[model samples]
Target: MSDFQCHPKPKRLTWAEAACFMVTGPTAYRQLFGWPGNVVKPGEVVLIWGGAGGLGSMAIQLTRIAGAIPIAVASTDERAKFCLELGAEGVVDRTKFDHWGRLPDTTDEAGMNHFHKGARAFGKAIWEILGTRQLPKVVLEHSGQDTLPTSMYVCDNGGMVVICGGSTGYNGDVDLRHLWMRSKRLQGSHASNFREYREVIKLIDAGLLQPCLSACGTIEDVGLYHQLLHENLHPSGNMAVHINATESGSTELA
Candidate 1:
């Protein structure tokens, strides 16, 4: 294997901008463009789970670039607005709604009812925003158990849900009837392939895809930022960590 597999950063992009694209860029590209069967056709509507975060930010831009309509869901109004600014056609502010339910030990009747109630309410809000005239053709999901049930419920018949990671929870409970009866598909994708990475790089170089960088710090601060992310206290968008292998110095973890 070659030491330098990726291309040199484009002259137009700053180090922060290039760094922001590292993982999120290719994943977003694969979700929208590199799906195996290409379920999301041009001009289709895509429901983005977190339009202001790393993956969702890139997904919104890619969705727009692909000539699709992006409907973004964010936890706050400011984040929703940011997603709109990034090209999402519609926004769902989750803070305004109460979608709550914990996984129960046994799918007991009461527990199952509670879970279904929350999922139904969430799906209703999505449907209200989308209206009967328009339903999402594809759902860009990664929140996993937190949103999968609703994602499957609200998706149009024959629509697809393409998931990458389970940021909230991985053990998702999907309604089999909605999936099998409606012929909807649930697909999983890992990281992007080499070709997908290059395709995203070309877009970055051509100025078609913009990097969503929120913050940048020296490698010394990597631990600090990692803790913030682990604690769910990190800010929205991508964070850049400047790595310099030649420089030798150890910063004590604070």
Candidate 2:
């Protein structure tokens, strides 16, 4: 196998740093700003799920750059603190809800009630976090089945939910009422196109975007990195594996 694969690296980013943001950075940018016809505008409120994770971390920073306010749903206290540092104006801990993003059987009335109950509590928490402010105008969603319902329900009328991945599961239950009655929109975004990706690269080179890499090591650490991610034990930031010794760079987040 080749020791390293070459690509056009951003001039301002060290090899390790570039590797850190390669996947998550462009994906976040596409979801929050670069998606055609789905731009997040100034003064809008955005809700970002997993706001401390690789994708959400970048999304939080991009939201700030776009002059929008970002609210984060974090899985842990440490992650919540990190989200705040990365520019999330408010953080809600997902652990508080027993089924924050889960849905039950539609065929069973009791199950449907249970799902709504959890969704209601989840929506209440978001509103309380924002106080009397208007509901979120955009939701940066990826945790599909677990959170899409809440994302649709909590967003303001004519708001949007831009989804990229489904870490939880693919199938999601969205209330058509929320879509048609409230005039809400659900937009699906995939990987960034060449032009969109480069836009974010420019932002990175200009120092407007920051890396959230929290761990890195040589090729020997590959197994460990996979273990961490596979087991969902990786920190809320990105991790990198250095293929070429010369590419070694500091992995600590600033």
Candidate 3:
């Protein structure tokens, strides 16, 4: 085998002069609203799960900038408050919402028995949150797991669900029958490409978009990083974590 060499370390990002928003805000805008069919119109309400996290915070601001009302779903009340500051028109308290009842109880045989019941309840809750029998035209799926079920439940007839991450897990039993019958579309999105990224940058430069960066930490502190991820003490309601490396040590960007 040939000898291998490690690459040089990149410069650390300092809190005093870092542009954390530059990365997430534009990317979120593209993922949430940049698709062909996912058009934004005035008076339209777009539901965004994980609304307080990095991508979610960006989505909220982008939605508002595009003149669409943003309905954000977050795990805590504090997150909801943060989302409002990011221009979310409405906030859903996921902690108060019944996730166990809304999602499939099992991926195996034992939980399948109650799957239909859970699916129905999930659908009803979605309808209630949307405030209409019709599905929302655009559903921005940010929390990969919790929002996946809600995506299937709430997408309006002929609407679209844009999925970005798999925080919850990939592969679940969705009621495809409903999707086909209703003509709803489920689309997956990943990190923004060059073109999309440039567009987002333009929006930021114009001051039409502002994404919140809530918490900041260092990558070297594996223990603290794991704890934050486990506890979900992340960007909720427009907050995001910024990991910064320093000569003294690593620090979290808040």
Give candidate 3 regions above 4 Å deviation. Answer: 1-18, 99-134, 217-223, 235-254
The ten-residue window of minimal lDDT in model 1 covers 245-254
Q: Give me the candidate number with maximum lDDT.
A: 2
Q: Report the candidate with higher TM-score, 1 versus 2.
A: 2
Compared with the true structure, all predictions reach lDDT values of 0.78, 0.82, 0.64
Q: Candidate 1 on 129-241: residue-level lDDT in tens? A: 65745667888888898778778877888888989988778788777878899998898977788888878888888989888778778888999999987775667788887
Choose the strongest candidate by TM-score.
2
lDDT per residue (tens digit) for residues 82-144 in model 3: 888888776766665444433544455555545555555655555576576544678887566
Q: Tens digit of lDDT per residue, candidate 2, span 1-254? A: 34233345666676688879878888988888755555899988899998988889999999999999899998888999999999888898988877545556567788778767877787777778768647888899988988898898888888889999888889877878679999998999887877767787788888898877788788999999888877778888788877765635643333
Ranking by TM-score: 2, 1, 3
Q: Estimated TM-score per prediction? A: 0.86, 0.88, 0.73
Q: Would you give me the overall lDDT of model 2? A: 0.82
Give candidate 2's error at residue 159 in angstroms.
Answer: 1.4
How accurate locally is residue 211 in candidate 2, as Cα lDDT from 0 to 100?
Answer: 76
